[model samples]
Target: MHTRKEFLRNALVAGCAIPFISGKDFLAGARIDDFSFTSPFIRVGLRRTYPAFSFFATDSLGQGRLHLSPILTEPPRSKAFTARTYRDSISYFNSPEDIVADWQVKCEEKKIDLISRKPGAEPFEISFSRPQNHATVLGIMREGQRVLLPCILHLPGLGTFIIESRVPDATIFYDVTARESTGETPFVKLRFDGAGAKGTVKYSMRSVTLFPRKKKIHRIPLFDGYRRNFINIFQLNPRLGMLANSSSGDARASTLFLYAEVARVTPPLTKTFTAMDLIRDSLETYISGKQGYGHPGWSGNHESLDSRPSLIIAASYYIKSTSNREWAQKNYPAIKKWGEEMMRKDSTGNGLIEYGYSGNSGSWDSKIGPANWWHTIGFGHEDAYSNILCYRACSMMSDEKIFPQDEHTRACKAFAEKTKQHFFTNFYNPETGVLAGWKSGDGKLHDYYFTFVNSMAIHCGLVDKVKGKEILTKLLEKMKEVGFVDFKSGLPGNLIPIHPSDSGSKEGFQIYQNGGVSGCFAYYFIYALILCELYKPARELLLGMMDSYAKNEFEGKCPNTGMTRVWKTWNGECRGHEGFLADSYHALLVVEGVDPKIPFLNELVHFLNALTVS
Candidate 1:
C-alpha cells in the first residue's frame, strides 16, 4: 500500500495533488463559514471586531440588525441594499439603477467607494454627481446617550467623507451622498443632523478591498474573468456537496451534472470523496424510493430520464477525470446497472430512449412541461438531449482501458455507436438544417430548432463539422432576428418560439420552457459552438454572458434576488426555485485552449472526436 506521502507524490506527478492534512485540519482550515456576508457583487466574513456603541440595552442577548437603504428608495422594500458575510469581514453595497457603492468592513474600520464605469453607460453611471440622489443611509437604533463615532461613510465621485457625532450625548444620524454640481466635477457629500451632531465633515477616501481575502484559497483551473464568478457562486453553499438548485431545495440530475463537471475540471477545488459520496447517496435514494432523503415523491417516476443519464455521465466523468480506476472497478456494478436501465428505455431497439407521461422529463419534473429538461416543450418519445447523454455515458463506460474488458463492456461500446448513428438519422431535420427536438413514437417531429439538442450533437460528435456549422449559423440568425441580446440572461433554449398548437400547456409559449432563454441549457450550446470551431461567435456569446453576469441584471431591473448567484433563466422570472443553477455557469470550464478548441471532459471529447473521424 502506498503511504500518504507516496500517494501525494504520485498525485503531484500526475499534475494533481491531494492535500496532505488530517480530517480535523481540513475541516478547521478549509471549511467556509456559514455566517459570511453576501451581496449582489460579493460575500465576506468577519474575523475580528473593534470597539463600537452597543445597540442593546442592559443585558441584551441577541444579534443587532444593521439596516441600509439607498436614497430615493424605501428602507426595507428596496432591492438596492444587498449584503453578505465573508471570512474576515462583512461586505455591504447599494446598487441603485446600476450605480454601485461597495462597502468593505474589517473589524471597526469601514471603506466605501463607487465602482468606476464608462461615461454615459446604460448599466453604470458615467459620473458621480447629485449627492442627494445617490445618497445611502446606514442606520441602527438604540435607546441611549452614546455617540456613534464615524456614523456614516459617504462616497461621491470627487472624494470620500464621513459623518460623525461631534457631541457625546447626541443620537447618531448621517447620510452618505454623491453629486455633481454646476461647473464642478461629481463629488461626495456628508449630511449630518441627528443626535445634536450638526454639520457635514469632509474626509479623504482610501482604498478598500471589495472581495474577501482568503486565508486558505483553493484556486480553480481552466477559467478566468467573469467565468470564474460561477465558481464563486458554488462556494457560497460549500456544505451541500451538490450545488443548491435554489436557496431552499436541491434538484437532482442537473445539480449532479454541475458538481461533476466542476470536479472534473478542477479536482483540487472539490473534495472528491465528498462529491462521490453525494452522487452515490443520490443514486441510492433514487433506487430505494425512500422518503426523507430530501427528494420525496420522486421515487415512483421512472420516466424522469435525467437522473439516470446525469448519474451515468457524472460517475463516468469522475472516473476519467481523476483516473481513479479503483473507484470505477469498485462501483462498476452500480454504474453498469444505471447504463443498463438507460439502454432498457430504448423499446424500439433503434438506440434512443422513449419518454412518456409516466414520470418527469429530464431534469424537469412533470408539472413543468411535457418534454424533458426543456420542461415546457412538447418533446417526448425519444428525446435528442437525453439520448446524446445516454450515448456519451455508454461510450465512457465501454472504454476498455477505463473498465474491465468483457463482453458486457464490448456490447455497451457497440450500443453507444449505434445510438449515435440513430440519433443523427432520427433527429436531424434536413429541412431546417438542425436537429429536431424530439421524434415521437407516433412518427411525428417536434421541430423547433432546439438550440441545446443541436449544440449537444456537435459537442458529442454526432454531427459533422459542415452540419454543425450550418445548424449554428441558423441558430444565430434566429437569435438575432428575435432581438435576443447578450448572454446575460443566457441563450434561448429554442430559436423559434413554441407554438401553442404544438404545446399541450399554455405556459409553453414565450414563457418558461416555451422559448425562454435558460443559462442552464446555454452551456451546452456554447460548448457546441466552440467545438464546431465557430470561434468568433462563441467568444462573443461567452464574453457577453460574462458581462451580463457581472452586471447582475435581471429583466429591466438592475439587480434581482438571484443576481448574487447565477439565475436559471435570463429573464429573471424565476427566483429561489432556480437560483444558483451551477450547471449553467460551470459550462465555462468545458472549453480550454488558446482559441477554446478543447471540449470539457477532455478524454470523452478525444474519444468522440476519434470516433467521428474514423
Candidate 2:
C-alpha cells in the first residue's frame, strides 16, 4: 500500500481531488484554542490567537440556507498537511485552536489582527478587514515561522478568505476547501466525511499593492472575474457534490434544470471533488425521491416531471466524461431502475412520457408545481420541453459505455427511437413552423412559438438536420417580425404571448416565463445554430451576451422586485429572483466548450477567430 506521503506527493502535482483524511489526528498536539469569533456570515477559530486553525460558514440569503464546512486551515507540518514550507510560512493561517506560543490578538468593530513574537526579532502582525462588499479579500505578508499580517478582503456569499504562502524554492500550496450538508438525512444524503480541503472555492490574491513583492501568490478561480465568472456561478460544494443556483441562497443545489445546463461543461476543478461523486449523489437522490436534493432531482413530485431525463443526462455525462466503465459496471442495476421508472411514465404507450397534469387552459394553478424548469408555464401531458430531454436521455442511457448490453439497454434504445419517431408529429405546430410548448391532455396544441422548445429539439437531433435548420430560420424570421432585436438581453422564452389560463400564475407578458429572456435556455438556441454552422447569427448573439457578462449585467438584483437578474424583461427590466442564479451563465459554456484553435483567447477579433466566426 502506498503511504499517505506518497499520495500527497502525487496529488500536489496533479491538482487532483483531495481524499478524506483526519486533520485532527495529524495536528492534535499542535492545537491551542486561544481565540474565536462567530457571525451569521463568518466564523473564525485561531490557534494561539494567531493564523493557524479551522472554521465553518453558513449563510441564509433570503429564505434559502447553505452550509460550508471544513474551510481551509494551516496545520502545523504534520501527517495530513505535511508541507514543511507551508507550515513555516509567515502567512500560514490555520485553526483558531492551533496555539503557537507568544501570540497576541486585538479586535475592532470591523477588524481583528494577530501578532507573533520571538525574543530577539521584530514583531509580526497580520490583520483582516472584514467583508464589506459582494466578495471578501485576504491580505498576506511574509517574515519567518508564520505571522499574522492585517489586510482587508471581501468574499461573496459565505464567510471566506485566503492565506497565500510563497517559498522561493518551492511551490506554495494552500489547501482551500468547503464542505456542505442538507441538514436532512435521506437514505442517500452524501455528507462529506473527513477533512483536508473540501475544494469548493480556491481563494487567492491576484496582486497585493501593500506587500513588498507586489506579486500574486494564490491563483484562485474563487469568485467573479475568473473564467468569465464560471467559478462564481457553477462553483462546487462538497456536501451537495453540485453547484447551487447561487451562493446567494435563492435556490438550493442541484436543481435539475441547472444541473442539466451543466451537462456540456466538464468539471472545472479536480482538487477535492469529482463529477462521479456528483452524479452518484444525484442518482441516489433520484431513486430516494427526496425534496431538498434539488428540484426534479427527486422523482416523488408528480407536478415536476423532468426528474427522469435530468437524472439520466447527468449520469450519462459522468460516464462519458470519465469513461469509467467500472462505475457503469457497478451501478448498472440502479441505472436500470431509473430507466424503468421513466419508461413507466408512458402510461398510454404513445412513446411520450405523459405527465400527470393535463396542462389544459386554466388548469395550471390548482396543481402543485410547474411541469418542468420553465416553471412559470403550465406544461404537461406530452410536453415538448420534457420530451426533448427524454429523447436525449434515452439515447444516452443506451450508450455502450453508460449501460451494459443487456435486454434493458435494448429497451432504452427502443424507447429513444420510438420517442424520435413520434416526436415531430406529436408536437410540431405547422401554423408557426416551430414546435409548440406542449400538447395538453385535453387534445390541444399549445403553440406559443416557444424558442427553447424549438431550439432544444433542433440542437439534440430530435428533429432532422434539414428540418431543424428550416425551423430555426423561421423562428429567427418570427423573432424579427415580432420586433425583438436586443440579443444582449437574450431572446424571450417564446414569441407570441400565452393566455393566463395556460400559465402557472397570472404573470404579465415579458415577465417570468410568460415571455422572459434568460441565458439559461438561450444557450440552446445559440449552440443549436453553432451546430448547424450558422455562424453569423450565432456569433452575433454569442458576442452580445459576452458584452453583457463583461459588464456584469446577468447577475445582481433589480430595484423593482429585489430579484436577481438571472431572468430579465424584453426591455431589460429585471423580473426574476435568485440574485446570483448559476444557470443564468450557462450561455458562457458556448465560448468555453467550443475550441477554435486558440488558448484563453478573449479579444473580440481573436474570440471570433477562435470560433471561426467572420
Candidate 3:
C-alpha cells in the first residue's frame, strides 16, 4: 500500500527520481517499491549519491518514526571486495533547537550564516583549560548553490538562528556533531530552515561523546500544523521532461491550479518565479508531450477521460489567479483538445464523445477498466460529472479566448444544455431537490445521493446555486437526524445515512449505512457548503470533522471512511491514504472565504502558528 506519509516523504526527498507517466501507464512496471529506501542510490545516470530516508510505522503522534534499514545499492562485481556502506543515526529535534554542538547560526534580514567550532580529538573540558582553545573551523551555506563549512566563529549571546538558502530545483545538505550531554545549562544550537528545501542534521552531545543515555530514542514533532501544508507548495518544481507526480501527468493545466493558489499569497519563501510562470511551463511540458499523456496524469490511470475537467479547472484557476493573457494564448490548443475530445459529443449520433472510455473514473484509484464498459446495468452514468466539468472548462476557455470567440461560446453553451437536458433530467429530483447518482430504467433512483456527485456538482458549478443550497440544507438536516451531523463530534461521510433508514439505527454517530460520517468528508462538506455560502453550517461541520480525526479512530491519518472494508454499511472505521489533499483543500476554502483576496489564508495562518508553537 502506497500510504500518504510514505509517498509524501518520497516526494519531499526524491520526487525527481521517479519517471512521470500518464494515466494509461498505471499498470506498467512502475513499482511502488522503486520509492523505497532499500535502494540507497537513485541512479539518475551520473547523479551523485543523495542522502534519503523512508517513512514506516510511527509511535503515537505523527513523526518520522521508521527504522529504515541501512540503504544500499548494487555494486559491480569487479569492485565487490571493497564494498561501501551507508547508514544514518537516529534523529531528534526541539522547539528552539538545543542539541550537543559548539555551533552558532546567525540570521538577520534574509541573510543566514552558520559557524562551527570543534576541538581536534581533545575533550571540551581539556580544550577549555588551554590558553588558546584548540582547533576551530567555520563554514557558510548561503542562498545560492554554495556550501562553505569547516570553520570558526567569534560572536556574542546570539540566542536565535536564521536559515538563508535558495535553490531553483536543488536539494540541500547540513550535518552537525556535538559532545557534552549533562547540563542544566541549556546547551542550545539555534538552527532555521524553510519547509521546502531545508534539510539539516544534528547530533546530541551525549550521542557524540558516548555518554550514558537517559532515553534510548526520541523524535520530536518539529514541523507541525499548516507550516507542513506549505511544504509542498513552495517545492512544486516539476523536473524537465518528466511529470512530478501522478497529478502532474499534464504539467500545463495542472500548474494553472497550483500557481493560482501560490500567486494568491505572500509568505516567507525564497523562490522568485510566480505560480503563473510555473503553470505556464507546466503547460508547455504537456503540450510538447514531454509529460507523456496516457500513463499517470493524462489518460493513463482509469479510463474515465475526465482529467480534462481537472485540467480545465486548473486552467480556470490559473487565469483567474494571474490574469495572464499570453499564457492563455500559448497553451490554448491542449486545453481545447481536453475540452473537445475528452468531453465532446460524438458525430455518430451517440450521446457521448468518441472513445469516451468510462474506464475507472476516480482521480486516485489506479484501477483501469475496459476502454468501454457498456453501462447497460448501472444507474448512474460515468461522464455526468465529466460533462459538468467540461462545461465549466469550456466556459473558462471562452472567457480567456482560448478557443475562437464564437466556437468557445457555442461549445460551452451546448455542453451546459446537453448536460442538463440528457443527464440531469434523469438523475436529479427537483421534488426532493437532490441530484441522485443515476436513474434506473426501472424508474427507481439508485444511489439517490452521493458526496462524490454533490462535490463535483458544487465544484464544477453544475448544481444550481439556490437548489443546491436547499439540497445541502436538507442533506445536513438528514445527517443530523441520522446522528451523523454532531458538531461536537465528527461529521458523517455522506448525508444520506448509510446505515439502515430506521430511526433506531440512526442513534450511532460516524456509522456508515448511507455512507456515514467520514473524516474524509470534512473538507468536501466544507467545500460544498462554503461554495454555496453556508458559512455557519460549514464552520460547525468542519470543527466536528477535525475533532473526529484528532481521535484517530477513522485512520492513523484523518478524512477517511469505513465503506469498502466493512458491510458496505454500518461500520464507521476508515482511513485515507491521500486525505492530506483534504486539509489543503479545506485550508484553501477557510482562508479564501475569510479574505477572498487571499485563498484559505486563515487555515494557513493556523497551520503556521501551530507549527511555530510546536
Q: Which number leads on lDDT?
A: 2
Residue 346 in candidate 3, Cα distance off native in Å: 5.3
> Per-residue lDDT of 105-127 in model 1, one digit per residue for the tens?
33222332222122321221111
| Displacement of the residue 255 alpha carbon in candidate 3, Å | 11
Candidate 2, RMSD to the unseen true structure: 14.8
Evaluate model 1: give its TM-score: 0.57
**Model 2, total clashes:** 38
The local distance difference test score of each candidate is: 0.46, 0.53, 0.35
Per-residue accuracy of model 2 over 1-614 as CA lDDT, tens digit each: 75533432332233222222233323332344324443332334445433344443323111111233333444354422111122222222233344332333333222333333322212232221111112322222122211122222223333222232221221111111122255321111111111123211111222111111101211211111223244334433323323345322322322454454454454422233333444455555545554443254333256355656777777777777767788777776776787787788898777898887788888767334656777667787888888887788888888886666778878989999999889999998888788988889888999988888998898788887789888889988988888777787677888878887887667788887778887777778987787666666776677566556544567656665666676788888888755455667677666555444532223333433333322
Worst 10 residues of 3 by lDDT: 124-133
Model 1 residue 46 CA deviation in Å: 7.5
Off-target runs (Cα >4 Å) in candidate 2 are 1-226, 235-242, 248-277, 284-289, 293-303, 559-561, 595-614
Q: Note each model's CA RMSD in angstroms.
A: 18.9, 14.8, 17.5
Model 3 lDDT vs. the true structure? 0.35
Considering lDDT, where higher is better, how would the candidates rank from best to worst?
2, 1, 3
